[model samples]
Target chain A: MTTSRRQHTLEVLVENEPGVLARVAGLFSRRAFNIETLNVGPTEDSSISKMVIGVAVEGHSLEQVIAQLDKLVSVISIKDVTGKVKEVHDTQPDYQN
Target chain B: MAHIPTANGTAMTGATSLVKSLEAADVEVMFGLPGGAILPAYDPIFDSSIRHILVRHEQGAGHAATGYAQVTGRAGVCIATSGPGATNLVTPLMDAAMDSVPLIAITGQVPSAAIGTDAFQEADIRGITMPFTKHNYLVTDPDQIPGVIAEAFHIATTGRPGPVLVDVAKDALQKMTTFNWPTSIKLAGYNPKTTPDAQAITDAAALIAQSSKPVFYVGGGVIKANAHKELRQLVELLGAPVVTTLMARGAFPDSHPLHMGMPGMHGTVAAVTALQKADLLITLGARFDDRVTGKLSTFAPNAKILHADIDPAEIGKNRHADVAVVADVKETISALIPALKAALAKNQPDLSAWLRQMNSLKSTYPLGFDQPEDGSLSPQHVIQRIGQISGTDTIFTAGVGQHQMWASQFISYEHPRTWLNSGGAGTMGYGVPAAMGAKVGAPDATVWAIDGDGCFQMTNQELVTCALNNIPIKVAIINNESLGMVRQWQTLFYEGRYSNTNLESKRVPNFPMLAESMGCVGLSCERPEDLDKTIEKAMSINDQPVVVDFRVHRDAMVWPMVAAGTSNDEIMIARATAPDWDSQEL
Candidate 1:
């Protein structure tokens, strides 16, 4: 079967609160997006949490989705790893300085 | 000592380490009942300003919260204690689940020490509410309370926005932990956004540009997203006529020349027959429910449908949408308007011949009703009079049963969200409180709560709320004196054994007298001539709530029914020689 293929990874920063996860999932479920996996964890600082998501999609539509997701109040930042595969997007700056 | 108002606008219980955090998260009101299990969390509420609405019944509290959310377009917050109290909140949670409302249920569970041994007032609330809620969490540790509450609200209001239950042990609320609100949110499974692809919009527009005849099938989403201007622009842009789904009554002005009013089994003949002939059909925000499409296979069979909706499952669940666009109806329709305008500028097809042909089909199947010398006042006639009396912008809410179906069939809505019925859930006894909510939402406009005797009694106690609040919701009860909707089935499908469907309301507190007892002016009409005066007095009254008991035909049945479990293709219309009244099915 012929198919269009593209993939993207995004980092989301969200408030570490109760209903936040449900709200985020609610958005994806509403759009009927099929996600491969989503990993959420606390940052080095307790005030914000980080989430990494991988989604299989068609064309460059990932950018448009990421742009819209970024507009939500709970979302702090988003990075499309489809092209930035070699580097980790969300990280604490090294203390070596 | 602090008085910080919470989400529901009442002052909260006690002081909490997360007082500032809760306040920051827009904690305005919370509906809750207090108990020993909730004492720990109660401490912070007293010091904070978060408000709580102490409810008489946990179920009512949850439903009230649901009503509030439906009107405000926000998440409803409710609280309950362990075991029975927690169980009471479950019904409304499930209701919210099916209706897709945003709800946050905070229940206090037994402390961790007393769990598993069946702690007093302890039941497995988290496990019970798990399948029903969109998501739930159990806070075993005190440190997680702040983050959990914050996350719970976010999740409940986002995405498809269903209720989320949070079970907090007694110890967790009292725990002394530093609270700092998080600024950003992240989750793997949940992300909500409406992004309609430009190409699909173009594809849908191409079909419109090519078809000899096309029609715009509008639904509630046009109003939900406030897309009236865009919808009008597109229909005018493409020069096609418009028809509305039930929820979409107000998208176009009913008086507009191009507007064909509501379409379905009870829809206008023009709307129904035009769909039979159209080559391309553009649907916005409306799901082709069985009521709208009498027989699925026969509904708009010749048309290549381009369906746009915010919900994805609706696209192919019942009817297949050729070019499915999953986005907010307003966003999608707004986008279509411009694209179709561009396409029309380049090449405008001649659809006048098609329009003339559909107009002819419309003339053939005009929507009409009869009041023939039949002694009983027709319920359809009553609704048509309601349509004739109330302006197009009037808001109408119906209790479940024959009355609701009649309103859906006869009345024409000229605005969106003006006609509110429990569409997806079909909950009885929802009309009064919902109409009360509609009055709350639209105070100046005329609001009517169309009810059946059986459904009215279920939530009749709320009539006190209407009188006390002084919100004049015109209550029109189609008193057939039986469980009308169910009786219709028992009469048609079940051999006329008629077990348990009969009404003994007269033996009890007859409905009209009960209205007078509730301090609302009451009127009863059995004759056709009395109908007009009764309705006029009802509209004129502004002092309190009012009820008009129009004694309709006792055995009236809603026609054009698709029996449950039967596919949408088979419909039992209102015709004679059917139901086989002469024989016995049993």
Candidate 2:
């Protein structure tokens, strides 16, 4: 079987608690998911934190990564922001023109 | 369920709140060892109603908790101090994680201020056990104790079960707190999907109806979900063969006609062959583990996979599933049964050819070991005899090795939860403590730990815990006088150059004498003629734990071998003999 790797971005909203970031990072490290970039900040709701993670992974492996992330109790929600970014770019009016 | 003490907003220490929270969880028994940091919690435990088994080691406590949880289908609880006490629990926690056993481990941390200051007996247990646990918490506040305990139990026992650790600060336990048991737990992202997708179930049914050679690949999750009856029903309806994995020994009755036995390395020939040649694999609650799949690319190459498990991560983690159903195994089977029946009424696949082929393989290459030419007792015989005499009602726990394999292959488990072992972790020294916990869980049932000489020596100190606590678990030491499985590998791949594999058990640490010193009834059997009487004597001892040292042949090896990272096609039925797959027609 041939597996083609792709870059996917995920938006994860988690509880603003101690070790929450460590839990997410630990999961990626242990499962060996390649993280391209990760950014975490407090959400409008200070109790919740949003993490934007860009990962280089294969099709099935990305699904596994999302599923594993979802299993964490601290994680509130996860959205695949990869396609959404493309949708936004496609719908946007050309500024240069 | 036992009476739970009312909180009533009484002012109490966090230690008292912790003990009260345990009572509220309906935890009847717990296994633990107390030390410096955890001394505060032990005081409340001493006054509490919960029966705490003071194990010699924290590892024993963790394994014992696992044993209790596996047998009783409740969250088993274990307690320990920081540093080494908590670190010792790392193995059992990982073992529980692999097997999906519900375990709640409570550890005492150094004071909150001293957490990162390298205080005496301090360890970052929560950070240490993150990967090994389903979830974990580090409680610094005294008020978080009750809530954390409750949530820990809830998370540990729910969905796909696993170990959860709660590390309470020493000051947190000692500080004054008012306890309030939460009426309900709410974790936004933690809800497990119990009901499977109707479309997925329908798709699986259609596939099953169309398949000619399908096998029900069952796993420990079936037993965990208490879905064995549903599994039996589905298998019978399809008239297909079933192969239980090592972790799922008693998930399906061994006596069932469709049962092809366990599959994987050291698995039955028929079971392994069935998986190798199957057209469709109806995987239920079982991940396609590397051990089971052999070489991943070649495993069931022709088979379309129907993977159903409560854990979504496991669905396509190993093999791609043609029809993936993520839900509780019980619910998945319940929904699939009706859909399958509807599909079968329209077009029933003929499996006569497949059944004939399976039966032929089963009869032709039945599981058996040759009598030792050296006249030493056969370990297989000793384990088989122990199973036969003890009967199917007995709960059998085994340490990892050739003995564990023999126990799985030789024993006929008719019911779920009858067999417990360290399947995923393959942790040795599991048998004795696990059996003690099992016996404690089911006082009336006969519990036996089938251990090897190498394994028995690791946690045999727990036999004292058993003796003192009235557990009365029987232990059968399959003393091969060597690391049997590793030695077998050396014999096979390393040209018999034994390197440190020999335990020299014949010289040091006489097992029976050790057992006697630990306040257990000790029995020794060196000859086949005396095996029955010695086992019977061990069985007859109801007031104390019994350890029987059976001196068996050291040269025996587990057969039906699939070398690690090799294809199942290369499975050897015996020494230098591979079954001719071409000759068997389906």
Using TM-score as the measure, the top candidate is: 2
Model 2 bad stretches (over 4 Å): A1-5, A58-60, A83-97, B1-5
> Pairing residues by index, what is the TM-score of model 1?
0.75
lDDT, model 1 = 0.71
Candidate 1, B234: how far from true, in Å? Answer: 2.1
For all the candidates, what are their Cα RMSDs to the real structure? 8.4, 2.5
Candidate 2 on A1-97: residue-level lDDT in tens?
2336688999999999999999999999998888888999988999999999988895447789899999999999999998786687688857845
lDDT of 1 by residue, B1-586 (tens): 0333233222222226334545666667666677878766666666656666565557656765666566556667777888999998887788777666778888888988887898899988876775467778878776666566677777777645678887888776665555544555556445655778899899887878888878888876665566787888778888788888666776787767787656665456567656666787788877777767766767777888988877665666567678988787677888888888788777789988877766665554445555645777988888778777876778888878888888877787666567776665677776776676566556787888888888888766656666766667788988888898888878877877788988865455577788888878788888888888888888899788898888887776665455654433343346431222223211
Interface RMSD of 2: 0.7
Q: What is the TM-score of each candidate against the true structure?
A: 0.75, 0.97
Which residue pairs of candidate 2 clash?
none
lDDT of 2 at B164: 97
Candidate 1 DockQ, CA atoms: 0.05
